[model samples]
Target: MSSLYGLRPLPSHGRFGYSAITRRPGYAWPNGARLAVYLGFNLEHFAFGEGLGARIGPASPEPDVLNYSWREYGNRVGAWRCLELFDQLALPTGCLLNTALYDHCPELVSAFAARGDELIGHGHTNAERQGDMPEAQELALLAGCHARIAQESGTAPRGWLSPWISESRTTPDLLAETGYDYTLNWAHDDQPLP
Candidate 1:
């Protein structure tokens, strides 16, 4: 049986003696079999010592906000390593990009865009919470994210995947109003209900 984190059990059979066994989200169920493949990647890293981060704006994301470095990580190098690995594999991935990432690494964004990779908004930065921020601030920052996306990818985003899955009550409604196609801030269900 397919599972994530190797702990959560699969769902049981529902009504009519049927169980959905989906492998990934947005996939077609074959004869009530739930199976799908996910194409996703999270791109995050810091350039400085990995502490205070860029510390530019009032809402700049924290670069770990703790130590300069740690086990199994490097400052500003993780993304490049991942990029190289993905490029070598010729794999397509969806980048849940923090706008700060774009502002910080335009070249990296270009690399992904060149591969036709999907870039979903991950807030203007990875620090302040879009779901927690005031609505006005959120909207303004979202607009800024699109502007930067265009600047980096040469196109505006059609989706939003908030950082850390920072979902709010109004996130769906707001994204709908903003003309987004979908969101990736909820539990991953194999069935495409929404």
Candidate 2:
């Protein structure tokens, strides 16, 4: 009887099964804190005009410099400023990182790693959606992201956030099989769920 009209049906016997919010037992966060706040600091890279991206203006022809440059600025300047602010506030962030960011700007990624932030895999790029890829291709994509981030960051990430929040039917299976501890694709929960 559980359903959300447009979404695919919840998987059977999945890692976390369906239960009414009211029926679940009360939970307390670590340190008995009533609330937990973690920043999702996204550092992404994008392919030019070939895949999905945000734009500062209306879409133009190929090689959309307007939009591409806008996104690039985040890596070049904005993210660094944000990191400084986070440091000033003495906050720890959960870095949502695209593997492509390592290729595009390794130093920037290093800045976050050096700050003791937790790097969460965010795929290779936001240019393409993973949801429509074939099963094998999707698996490779997942593995590639994990490998590249591990190689560059010196530690494999334990969490994932699909590129553009895109995912295939088997994304969860891929995550579990490939050694990721959790994913951010599910947005309904305020707390991490098993």
Candidate 3:
């Protein structure tokens, strides 16, 4: 037992070691403003009769048409309306894109690209999660997403937000290898941390 049991420091983990924000160097944001804003608009697709999804009603056993159709509405109609609103407000957005949207309804994706919004990788689809995949499979998913976004959007995505904010142990390493410069998975604070 130590003299001050309650004051012992905990061991640090992860590649980013612990450091208090107050002790770190301070810098002003662009235009000398302390805040900046960007919208994270998610455009996703789901597999029918399988995997995970958000629901507007109680869970059905399987092949839930009500829920599936509800989600599909966002792609077919809702996203367009939202885009129009963004344009009216003259705001920039960062789309957390599911690559499946490229095949399912490319026009929707093209609309975002036309507005010069940033496309951030959000996997091939939201039906499954990257955290559940093995390392090799996760890497493949990351690489596939990078390539798809670059080909379809014309500008390659500089960041990623794992489907459902899910990731395997090697996600960071894999993201770097696949050319991602940032991630939205962690939001512990207003400022971006290493």
Candidate 4:
């Protein structure tokens, strides 16, 4: 297909075969409910002054305490408050976790686990992007995260959400090979895709 500018369309991610939403058969939700809601809470950790993170101000040199601390505030304070609210509301939460939290603040992860929240793998830390790694390295990373989460949480995560939502060409295949049942990498539709 060609664009208005006469440029060829970009290649597709071949794994996701197309199926127009309107043409696809409808399915009922669990408990015959008309709606479904899930809270995806992220709990990530970043290296000090090294690697990617959301910056609030202009970039600075190494040891960027300003940006590092800004992101840190989430794990330090924000997450706790959010946890309290979730508990009070009796909400079920799926926590996309960075395994590094095991070193930084294990209590936080334990608190969520104690509440019977679902823990999903989200890489070791947000400091690095999985998309940039070589295939073997990415596989190792995925497998390691799976093992760690299973060991810590007492169950393997059935889902994954890459750091920064980044993925290499082989991510989906790797996810399947490594035993992940689903991923949050794609957002082309409101409903889940095969």
TM-score on alpha carbons, each prediction: 0.66, 0.89, 0.91, 0.93
Best-first order by lDDT: 4, 3, 2, 1
Q: Provide the global lDDT of candidate 3 against the true structure.
A: 0.90
Candidate 3 on 45-156: residue-level lDDT in tens? 9998999998999888899988999999999999999998999999999999999999999999999998989999999999999999999899999999999899876778
Stretches of candidate 3 exceeding 4 Å from the true structure = 1-13
lDDT of 2 by residue, 88-138 (tens): 999999999888877789999999999989999998898888998999989
TM-score winner, 2 or 3: 3
Top candidate (lDDT): 4
Q: What TM-score does structure 3 among the candidates reach? A: 0.91
**Between 1 and 2, whose lDDT is larger?**
2
Best by TM-score: 4
Q: TM-score winner between 1 and 3, please give it.
A: 3
Q: What C-alpha lDDT, on a 0 to 100 scale, does residue 143 get in candidate 4?
A: 96
Which residue pairs show backbone clashes in model 2? none
Tell me the lDDT of model 2 at 180. Answer: 97
- Higher lDDT: candidate 2 or 4? 4
State candidate 4's TM-score. Answer: 0.93
- Model 3 lowest lDDT segment of ten: 6-15
TM-score ranking from best candidate downward: 4, 3, 2, 1
For model 3 the local lDDT of residue 33 reads: 92
